[model samples]
Target: MAEGGYIDFHVHLPWREHDPREAARRLLAEMDSAGVERAVVIAVEPSLKLFKERVNAETIRKAAADALDYLVYMRIPRLRRILFSPEESLNEHERILVEHTRRSEDVLEAAEASGGRLLAVASYNPELGPIGTLERIKGKRYLGVKLYPTLHFCTPNEKRLRPLLDYMESEGLILIVHTGCDPGIWELPDLCSGARPSSLEPVARRHRDLVIVVAHLGSYSALKPGIYFDEALRLIERYDNVYADTSAVDSFLVELAVERVGYDKLLFGSDYPYVTGLTIADFVESILRMNIEWRAKMAILRWNAERLLKRLGRL
Candidate 1:
């Protein structure tokens, strides 16, 4: 790895069921072999009872603390708890909703237990109920908040959700949102056709200072080869605070994103364990070879995350 260069973000981890030590060993090995400098592990714990590790807007964190605990160490690859805040809109059991709260504590403890290798991304619907979780978790350490209107089943345009967005903006927290087509997956049928990128216009219009992260590369459509090229261009043009990540996005699409959005607004991420680190690294390195400056490439890989960490004061 180049001096001081690292893979800005990596969101995968192993569970008690999977083994964190082994996951860490494997991750470290992979990074060493690939020359990936530093990496970020966004701890996640999925809702297994939700029918087979099904991922949705509600399960935004994507993994459990037990699993996330696997990757924690003294700190070879920095650990971050992508603290997933579960939503109750789809959960009738209230028990299921409370589970997210319980899990948040477990995750925080686990992150601290590893001596601080975790980060949290609390996600919830503003219209659902009082955001006690946000108020409570504020003074503590966390990366920011992640939002998914397309999956948790909220219209980003809803006036009801605005207050929460406004609050987040004032809090100076980073927000991540899934823009574009969610695709039809059996587990999260509701997200198959959720809010589109344009729907975010209302929130973006209101909270210009909020650091918004656009995930899935805007998942656009109607292009000749079916790329999000236009959508990426549009979102960057519309929101100054808006940033895009490489989560679950393909290599070709990643290049398109870099090509269209430029390097500054682009951040490197793997949505992790959902998408492998090796797969992501392959694409990033490939595109970077084609006349892109090393500085810009490094910016996408590290500086972007550094900026967010500084904003969150996580240094």
Candidate 2:
């Protein structure tokens, strides 16, 4: 955990009434302590506002601010960067009761003003519009399409989302989905309860060419107390395009997941704001203490993501 190399693909940013730079600096210090080399900073499109109203306590974390935090504290042997998706990018087609439009240009301008250390994910909810809306995005800033089935009022299996998924598949874009056999809450479960990773079978069958990345490795679920592990793993088995991350995950589960999935199929992520170095390092230590080979263990920590990114030309 001291001095080594690791790339964190899934990390979050804190946007709760603090200087974005300061928040990122604190996070960077923590990442340094954990031996994380580079990080893929991800910001979601503020799609949440459509579904959930603000309680006086919690503020929305914009995709741009998350990217800003990463840049603010970016300096080290650190490949500090972020993946940001404005919440409103996907809602352009629909006529909401409220007109909440966080345009891609606006998100980009805010991010550029923050200096550097930012990249983005272009989000298109084909549910909102099909050919025109999605076609508007040339996708210069984004690595791929980020789909929030829950926030946009569509499940992954919905016929409406299929066109967008199909576009991504045909275009070879990386499609990141929120999965795990989930409940029915727009903020909670974007995909349907029946739309588990296994539920993605339809999409997988139709779009075998797409690189479907499942967020948090399908960690958040209803597997009883300890029975859900196999259910999560079932996703990886079900889809070849499926990939999982270590974001927002606890230590024991991370180690167990590495054991089950092996290092090749896994990636590192903090689900930041919600994720922390202490949370990830503790898991790394637990896994390293086992009799596993150092290479496999280290691959889970760092090498795996590197290979994937290289394949995507991010490296």
TM-score per candidate, in order? Answer: 0.65, 0.64
lDDT digits (tens) for residues 98-149 of candidate 1: 3323233443443453443445554553333326546645675555555555
Give the alpha carbon lDDT tens digit for every residue of 117-236 in model 2. Answer: 333455554334545436755565555665555445445677766667777666666776665432212122212343345556677678888777666555554322222346557666
The number of clashing residue pairs in model 2 is 13
Cα error, residue 182 of model 1, in Å, equals 4.2
Candidate 1 local distance difference test against the native: 0.53
RMSD, one per candidate, in order? 11.4, 12.0
**Which ten-residue region of model 2 has the weakest summed lDDT?**
76-85
Of candidate 1, the 10-residue stretch with the lowest lDDT total is 74-83
